[model samples]
Target: MAKLKEKKALMIIAERNFRDEELLEPKKILEDREIKVTIASTSLQNSRGMLGATVKPDLLLSSVKVQDYDVIIFVGGGGASQYWNDPLAHSIAQKAVQKDKILGAICIAPVTLANAGVLSGKKATVFSSEISKLEAKGAIYTGKPVQVEGKIITGEGPQSAEQFGEAIVKVLENLPE
Candidate 1:
């Protein structure tokens, strides 16, 4: 297979309690495709995963700009729920969408997308536990593993992380640089 022409930057944005599987699985998939994956967070010291694992970030949200990437992904977990309304998280989601970059949110991270005004009137799928929250924010909820509507893509939960990663890869392959 010819190498994909498009280059994607997988942005894994997590909080202190992000799920390990949700972030790692997708990241591994993207990197296997030779796409650059950057792990960014609210802070840079270290963030704890949902299962009590520790993860380091490649960049800090305060330091990184969104336009440098072709794709921006939000990793979801219990920690994301607490920080979904964060101004910095919201800012990244909003700016990525505004720039027409491929935006993704898995599990509870979709709440951040809703908070960023990216899901309004768009068909999306997120972890079912928060479907009502997304709907309340004007999202058209789809109860599925992965849903890609335009430049935005969302996955249901950790169980669907692999599919979500593949979906993102497919989208990246199709989009021109």
Candidate 2:
């Protein structure tokens, strides 16, 4: 038997509105395994979810250092579009890819990654409304509830949040220890 290496995950949510389940479901899955989860957002104030789950961000997105975590996830909602073309979000996504850290997004947040140029040639999925944006970025849209391609993971929407979290944990657990 061997002790597992500690893992840390950074979850980015929208300042005003994020999908509650998308953030909570995944955060629970990761924390159950004793993995540390940090919440980040565009602002340092409390973030309100679409479903009314208010969360205080631990840090601002502009201050994130990709090297500090094993995974980086963007929680999606109607407001997730705020990061669709955001340079800071795109830069973070690119750095995560460049560093080979597990990258994940649920619902519409995948659009942020697609726009970041890291989804090119990767298999991914997103909320139906965002399919074209992913396809336009050269990502093969699989339309699955949850899709895991290499170290990148994407979920169709809130209903897929749990499976998305499971997929991320699977990837993290299987990484060379």
Candidate 3:
């Protein structure tokens, strides 16, 4: 059998509150670039949004080890208000950064980065509602569609999801061999 082409793996983690466009749009863009995007959640089964939209997770966050992914992305939602506070999620986020993997988060999901202790002293952009909170975590807040500081990238909200996705593609494309 011919060897399958190896593709970069992107891990998108979100709770049921993940905004539809925020997560799905990025996934689509990554897929278009032939990058493997996996949707992981607190559980292995499907997770539903506040609007009752159901999304199946490719893997369970609890079972995921950050070393296996090339990038780790967190999606925002009102649901993130709760999810970000989960200890396990913070652990995974911290692990990703410690492993030097690219970390991306949109909207309120940046809260995960803040909570993970990675945003300290880094410039980041996040949902308007959480700008103050992000600042409190020692992140320099900005009002931009996307901000890429080193291996970390952050977007404001669902409105910037498409650009957020594109930013990730460019970052990945330009990575050193």
Q: At residue 107, give the lDDT of candidate 2.
A: 99
Model 1 per-residue lDDT tens digits across residues 14-90: 65888888888988898888887888886787899888778889888787688888889989888887557788778
Candidate 3 wrongly placed segments (more than 4 Å): 1-5, 50-52
What TM value does model 3 have?
Answer: 0.91
Candidate 3 pairs with clashing backbones = none
lDDT of 2 by residue, 7-125 (tens): 88999999987999999999999999888999999899999999999999999998999999999999999889999999999999999999999999999999999999999999999
Q: Assess every candidate by TM-score.
A: 0.92, 0.97, 0.91
Give stretches of model 2 more than 4 Å off. 1-5
The window of 10 residues in a row where model 1 has the poorest summed lDDT is 1-10
lDDT of 2 at 22: 98
Clashing pairs in 1: none
Query: How does each model score on lDDT?
Result: 0.84, 0.93, 0.81
Error of 2 at 67 (Å): 0.2
